[model samples]
Target: MSDDLKVTAELRESFGKGAARKLRALGKIPAVLYGHGTEPVHVSLPGHQMLLILRKSNAVLELDIDGKGQLALVKDVQKDPVRQIIEHIDLIVVRKGEKVTIDVPIHLEGEAAPGTTVNQDSNTISLEALATAIPESVVVSIEGAEDGTQIFAKDLILPEGSSLITDEDTLIVAISIAQEQDLGEETDEAPAEEAAPAAE
Candidate 1:
């Protein structure tokens, strides 16, 4: 389940690349909050804390903005390609018990049968769960699975109060026998007579 962490945010008046750079220099991250039929609010959030909170998937936050508490869901995060530093974030407001559709990662546990390889076809599956109850990831066991075994989306056991939103026939994991290619045999060279004739 997603845990809501409290964070303090200050309203930001500056905009554009220059302003964002300044905020980053001061260890603040620029972000926008919008939802619940209200106008978008621009603010600056603490950089280190924001990065830590965002390490979890589908992070929820209880924002304290001037003594007014607001519930927000992590919607999007943009980052620098080389430095991998967070650039900006977009948060969507949500209420308790609100149902939201999100994609959760599939984690395969255990090993398949010997001489077989497990191939994952889908990395994520969509689910409809409560805003605060969204799972971090779904775990599927492949223990002792034999070759030609297939696990489909319809067969997934979802967490309580969650329902699958992805297609039922989606292929999640497939187990198959490992194929080995045989290298061609080396041929013997018909050798030295031609070199000796050329030398003569």
Candidate 2:
């Protein structure tokens, strides 16, 4: 959180769907910044620059607005699926040391013990971490784990200034036996009935 992300932004003069379409046509994204009990400020950002900076989830953005500096957090983003472009974004003003709950992805590294398969039911863990220093993701080691072994939220080791916001017993990952594939020809399992001798 060293203010590594900086973007050039300007005050949005016009507002509405038509105005937004015009901005998009000009390769700019319409955005709003509101938080900390301040009035929502409408602005426009460079589409390319904003996309690059938003590569990281919960990105901390430093906005240079008309030569003034503003600290903000990426709270929401709206995008077009087909075009893969940023349509709009919402930013929340935040200060250092403020806590926020966000989902940190779970990274499972290393192969499980021989004959044991890894089942990842939870890919991200919800935790309360500093808005400024929130971790990019959470790493859990399943190395040499045996079958039926489970790792829970309470067992996670958080870095300083971070706290567990999710349930303690929430299962994150477990080691289990792999399912065997059925490769044989399919057949109906209903048993055939025996016939009487010549209907006697």
Candidate 3:
């Protein structure tokens, strides 16, 4: 794991909504770590630092729990609906080189052939990858793709250590001829109708 992914966490003994609110007031986030048949551990993490790290999807954190190191994969995040503030987080313990299944965002690159519009059917796909080696996202290039061209999940080129877990037949991107609107014809017809009403 990179040094930037490391965070020092404090074990928290408090519970309930009141306790969680207090932690957030102090710029801390409450999180639970559990997995591998171990009991769940509750801890508090720094708010600002976590927000920065979590901006990227499927973020894995190297947590320092009282000078002890542990690897955790971000499982879920709860946020305030209106404020969009991070409320709590769930982390799953993972071992080095362990394979974990997660969803990776899809990123499109390049433009399709001229006069063609590209449509993405799915925004993210599931993948199985090493806990620490998960790719941030998968890229699908539509460069020079002609109309009627389609790309499926099976056709995607994944990162070296990742394998696609999504259904093989899922459509990822489709390129088609752009539909043109006949605005000029509509305008001409509207003026004729108005002129008829005026003559009557």
Where in model 1 is the C-alpha error above 4 Å? 1-4, 181-200
lDDT of 2 by residue, 78-159 (tens): 9889986788999998877788888888888788999877888888888888887888888888889998899999888777
lDDT of 3 by residue, 5-120 (tens): 99999999989999999999999999999999999999999999999999889888999999999999999999999999999999999999799999999999999999998999
Task: Please estimate how well model 1 matches the true structure, expressed as its whole-model Cα lDDT.
Answer: 0.90
Measured by lDDT, the strongest candidate is 3
Please give the ranking of all candidate structures by lDDT, highest first, separated by commas. Answer: 3, 1, 2
Which candidate leads the pack in TM-score?
A: 3
lDDT of 3: 0.94
Q: Any residue pairs clashing in model 1, and if so which?
A: none
**Model 1 misses residue 13 by how many Å?**
1.3
Candidate 1 residue-wise lDDT, 71-158, digit = tens = 8899999999999989999999999989989999999999999999899999999999998888989999999999999999999989
Q: lDDT of each prediction vs. the true structure?
A: 0.90, 0.84, 0.94
lDDT of 2: 0.84
